[model samples]
Target chain A: MKFNLKKMLTTFILFFCSIAFLLPFVWMLSTSMKIEADVFKFPIEWIPSRWNFVSNYQEVWFGDHPFYLYYWNSIKVAVITTLLSVVVSALAAYGFSKVKFRASAWLFLIVLATYMVPPQASLVPQFILYRYIGLFDSHLGLILLGSFSVLGTFMLRQFFMGIHNDFIDAAKIDGAGHWRIFWKISLPIVKPAVATYAILRFIWTWNDYQNPLIFLRTDALYTIQLAMQKFTTINGSFYTLIMAAAVSAILPLLIVFILGQKHVIDGIALGGVKG
Target chain B: MPSNPSIETKTNIRKKQKNASKRRETIAGFLFVTPMLIGVSVIVLFPIVATFILAFADWKFVQSIDNLKWVGFQNFQGLWEDEKFIKSVINNAVFMLTVPTTMIISLVLAILIDKYTYFKSYFKVAFFMPYISSVVAIAVVWQVLFHPSQGPINQVLMSFGIENPPTWISDPNFALLSVMIIHIWISIGFNLIVYIAGLQSIPKELYEAADMDGANAWHKFSNITFPVISPTSFFLLITGIIATFKVFDLIAVLTQGGPLNSTTMLVWHLYDMAFLNLEIGYASAIAVVLFLIVFTITILQWISQKKWVNY
Candidate 1:
């Protein structure tokens, strides 16, 4: 009975805390569906009495600063960046781990050292270089900014190092070259780790606000983050509309979290175990 | 055994073939890493070298490189008298408090869920939801919640018989605190999930032995759980402090370091100088300071971890 009481008490406490934790999101969803007058109504309406869901959403999606364009821009930039970086990082990882060379360790240490330097510290030079190179204010500039991550390369290298040297030796004996072994043997062994990194890369790119904020100047080229900020700034008074915009911005992440929960969990676990 | 000319020739040929393949492997390895090398050199490494050099020179984005003039410690010297810069540094120091607070709360909740809760994954997902959401979206929602008059947070406060509740996000005295609250809220889930992972990695036998010794919950936790998870704490601490210095999105979306520049962080201050005021040299100085701060803190944390952290 005492054990049952303790478990019940702990569950109740955690359950309440979870509710509080989720309240903002839940409130966001609720307020998005509410009418303007109903939004600030006292006693806190958990469920909207007067639903303005369609119009609020339509105003956000089809009205000024059309979210669809930003969504498309974000999708394009994030997808291309993630795919390019993953491939580059994976190749670099395989080379550093599987292929033996004299300068390999020294080169990798340089790369790892760069990871210690925060990206914020290098913004000015990057901005200037981009302008000089005529790539400023372009999606290509934004894409290239995140296309290579030192952290990604370093992380994937650890996983690649886990693959047994025997596999590489056997592949070489079978007349397979380094590239063939990387694609066929080593990569397959680390697919889950690669996938985890790719998912993280995609999410990080998708949620990135800084790169897009600084690099892209044109409103036409704005990603969802830029669009969301602009939308909130202009519609500061319209609580319902702003909430709608917020929901629209976060919905995709929720979908991604739902779909890739296992991978995400595994990724966090990988990070923990790595330490 | 008699030396055979054909056997000796065959062995020589095999040695040459091995040498050739080794050369090929080295070339292939270089080829594989070429893209990453180029990208890092251009995007990351080159820019770092420039940031350091630019700190002593005065230049704007629109100006040509020939127009760049050396200012020689003027930028760094100016930072000493810059009130906003000083405030930003102090605000960032205040923001660092979120790390330990988040870690402690997450550790407690992690223990509760790991040891007692039934719906483990559900709880994990709930806490992690905000962490994964876009900062822009999350900040926008919080802007509404921090609404002085009609927001739910103040409304609850008002209901409890307080006549005047301090306006959050707008009041300079409370603005930094408000941002910190949101940051702590967003961070708890991530720390919680990581702590849970850390908790699971603790050896079961340790807990079993504690139970055999008739040790209480707090005793087991302090002696076993805390020490065992010290390495995890150290990891989170380092990464979390690094993250605190990089806090830009929230300030950009929510406050823009506004209401008397109370919420200004190092990154935000640097950004304002570089982009808004067109003071590239001054901003680079700020960036260099930011880098030195992070470098120093990380080294300090790494050194201190040896005192408390278990292998």
Candidate 2:
């Protein structure tokens, strides 16, 4: 219970560091909601003196070039990709963790080895393949590309191992099939992990700029990030508006993290070394 | 780690499950990973193989498809002569050195937070706040902060009587480092949390034993702490190197490899080559090089883990 000066110094340094880390975000949020005049004043304001939330959010959401479609497109892609990734990765994790087959080890190694392949190496051929198949610029193409996550599969596999295998055996003796063992028993044990991965996957896909930016042609088909970039224009006149757009895009992610961060931290703390 | 007693008790049932179950399970395993296998094959694996094939050919990507200039060894042979790809590789090497320095700093900070009990969770959450938020947002905020005119960063410098700070993201000199700074800030939260876990996993008895030997804090750290946590350091280094190699988002936003391509690394160059110039064949060659570099390094790290990593 003693208050040591060393602990006090550590706490103080951390507080300053946190302030330093959090201030830019605080500045961006304030700037996005401020009047253009207030944005560039000599003395930077951390908070908008007058609240301009309604207009800022409005311009970002329903301006001359509305972000509504972009919002829907991003959300749609993220949701579908998350669902597909979760289902596939959970199954893959289960197979790697629970299913006993002669080929299981090899299959698991292939999956693990696949993670080592960098995605940029795939860009050119995937583009050509998509173009040939006429999946280019299509939402389905984006979803298809985004749906597979080897990292997610590997991460979930680690979690499934942490689960007690007795449940799997108990279910097998009840005449449960492989599917039933996965669905009824294994699924419940790894729900926290699944949820953890889903959050990470959702953030990853939502923030993804490259794939959609390349494949998507129409401004209306844009994700929020791309749409915001277009909204700001390449020339950068609408920089303040760009900040507003950035703020709106980041808002949802911040919410997701604040809500789910405990799980992610716990999962990472427990999960990283083993992997 | 669990055994089914029924597999021992009921031989006939076990044999039936084994025979029929073998086919059923194989099919099920394939079915389970079908989406990932298909998705990964189309988007990742197959494309990679195709890139290697395209390296030896000359497809204009969007142009004439029929006539492929069979340039055997020319593309790769051309790589050594090319300046930009070479520069891109060099920039990547510089980046590789700088990025890990940032992550190491974070690891130290995380250990400090962990060693002190009070408000550890609060510090952990605060440190990680930037990571969960959008990278684009962070870049934009950073652009403003690095603004030569009124940014708090240069502003503080100016107040200290430092004149004419280099224009970050605008000057070719500091652009790559500027981008790395933002990357460090974003990735610190992640690396810090990982190390805190590493610190916790170390046995308290080691420190207790060291204390009985009248070891100072520094001695205890070097003796018991660093070795125990070296595995986490190893993981961070490998992941850091890989992530640095594939880094694209921030560069595409902040500098666009501008200030005259000083910040352009392998993946960014690949993006420019493929999407910008439509030189798919050449870009494929470049991507093929990156894949080889990254894949080789990852394997080497995995092999070397035995020397340092404990658990």
| Candidate 1 CAPRI classification by DockQ | medium
lDDT of 1 at B6: 80
Cα lDDT of candidate 2 equals 0.81
DockQ values of all predictions = 0.79, 0.64
**lDDT digits (tens) for residues A34-57 of candidate 1:** 999988888999999999999999
Candidate 2 chain A TM-score vs. reference chain A: 0.92
Predicted model with the maximum TM-score: 1
Per-prediction TM-score of chain B? 0.95, 0.91
Candidate 1 lDDT over residue span B162-244, tens digit each = 88999999999999999999999999878988899988989899999999999998999899999888899988888888999
Clashes of 2: 0
Q: Candidate 2: which docking quality band?
A: medium
